[model samples]
Target: MELIEKHEEILERRAELLEQMESRREQLKIQRTKQVEKSEAARHRNITLLQDLQKIEDRLRGRQLPRPHLLALETRYWASVEQSVPAWEHFLLGKGPHPTDGPGQPPRRTKQTPSTAKGSGLPPRPKPRTAR
Candidate 1:
């Protein structure tokens, strides 16, 4: 039950933080004309992640929520629980849908083979055999 309570708390906190963060972002946009939106975006993004963390933390707390009911969830995602908790944990607990497992890295780009186009810098491949 402590897990549920913590989840509730985290969900609540996440909502509040997201709301404030977004509002601040909007304010920054309206207030600052063109100096730098990057900083504001970065700030809001950080807060947004923190909110997510709260949500996740709540999930770790789970329905049991004993002394540290979250331990299970922590073990499940030991390295990741601290990430913005709310949104993350919410998803973790949800039934509708969830993100897929980790994606492997994209295939590394190899050197492009030389094409027939003029002035191409790539080395040419050996000629292919022609049909008799």
Candidate 2:
């Protein structure tokens, strides 16, 4: 009779442990679902904000305004170019290379013909013998 009671106690403990494990598993599932929903909401909010910013930028571009200082600066730049036009033409027509092609680039090397051929007069190298 005592043995039967001990076995029943162990079986009851096992059933309680299984029930607790199942409950914990369900709670974890619920937490994961909540996290996913929050992430999706954040993504949607970011997209909406970016769209609103783009709209504001488009409106600003459509109604462009000219400032007086910028116009003055442009006029001065063009006037200086016009004043120096004759000097620029003289430099371009000069015999030296253009200033734009500065000495920064390396000079190209030319390929030489084989020295042993025909009128080169150099001795030819011997060919290596192959083993059988």
Candidate 3:
């Protein structure tokens, strides 16, 4: 009889242990889900900040306002700039690299203004890279 009683007590203890373990496992799963949700929210916030920065840069370029740096502009154009205008032409306009060119080779680099103004301002044009 005593032996049977001891076995019954051991079985009850084992059942209690398994119940506790199952409860802990469920709690862990809930915590993991919360962590994943937090990470996704952070990523979304970062993307929104990047988009705002791009809009601010556009405003700084002065696309909405008239600018002295703007040469012949039809709808804020860059055709003259896009095509190969002579380096002297930029010099005549009082904006460009110093006239430096090899007799046979093209100029090594073109000149451009570095503007600090922002808020709808156009970005500075790229300087042409000529042969060394």
Candidate 4:
């Protein structure tokens, strides 16, 4: 009879140990799930930060570089000026017609000095009166 009671007690102890082990396993599973969720949240935040940084870098690079169309326009303007420099110089030196003058327009005349205008036969201007 004593041997039977001892065997039954051993079985009860085994059952209690199994129950404790199962509870510990369930707690470990909950902790593992929480860790996985936290890791995933951190990964998402890191990806978002990287994307934002890329956008900022792209904007900065865009500001640094000139647009192709504007660069082309500027190059063409300078080339046109270079090509017309000789004509502009001739016109400024009075050796060529004005660049913008139309056909049949009279040539620009030089301003005449008072001594030169005397021979033009115009009446002389009266001198200004002095304050008495």
Q: Using TM-score, give the best candidate's number.
A: 4
The CA lDDT of each predicted structure is 0.69, 0.79, 0.73, 0.89
Q: What does candidate 1's lDDT look like per residue over 12-120, in tens digits?
A: 9999999999999999888676546768788899999999999999898776644565776666685565555654564455432334334574433333434433345
Distance from true location, Cα of 37 in model 1, Å:
15
- Per-residue lDDT tens digits for candidate 2, residues 25-89, read 99999999999999999999999999999999999889856688998999999999898777557
Model 4 lDDT tens row, 1-132: 999999999999999999999999999999999999999999999999999999999998878557899999999999999999997798877578877677888876656679867987779979999999
Candidates ranked by lDDT: 4, 2, 3, 1
Those runs of model 1 whose alpha carbons end farther than 4 Å from true positions after fitting are: 34-132
Ranking by TM-score: 4, 2, 3, 1
Q: Among these predicted structures, which one has the highest lDDT?
A: 4
**Model 4 TM-score relative to the real fold:** 0.48
Tens digits of lDDT, candidate 3, 67-98? 65664365346664555458667766757554
- Choose 2 or 3, whichever is better by lDDT: 2
lDDT of 3 at 36: 93
Q: Considering only N, C-alpha and C atoms within 3 Å, which residue pairs clash in candidate 4? A: none
Worst 10 residues of 2 by lDDT: 107-116
Candidate 3 least-lDDT 10 residues: 110-119
Compute each candidate's TM-score over C-alphas.
Answer: 0.25, 0.44, 0.43, 0.48
For each of the candidates, give the backbone clash count.
Answer: 19, 0, 12, 0
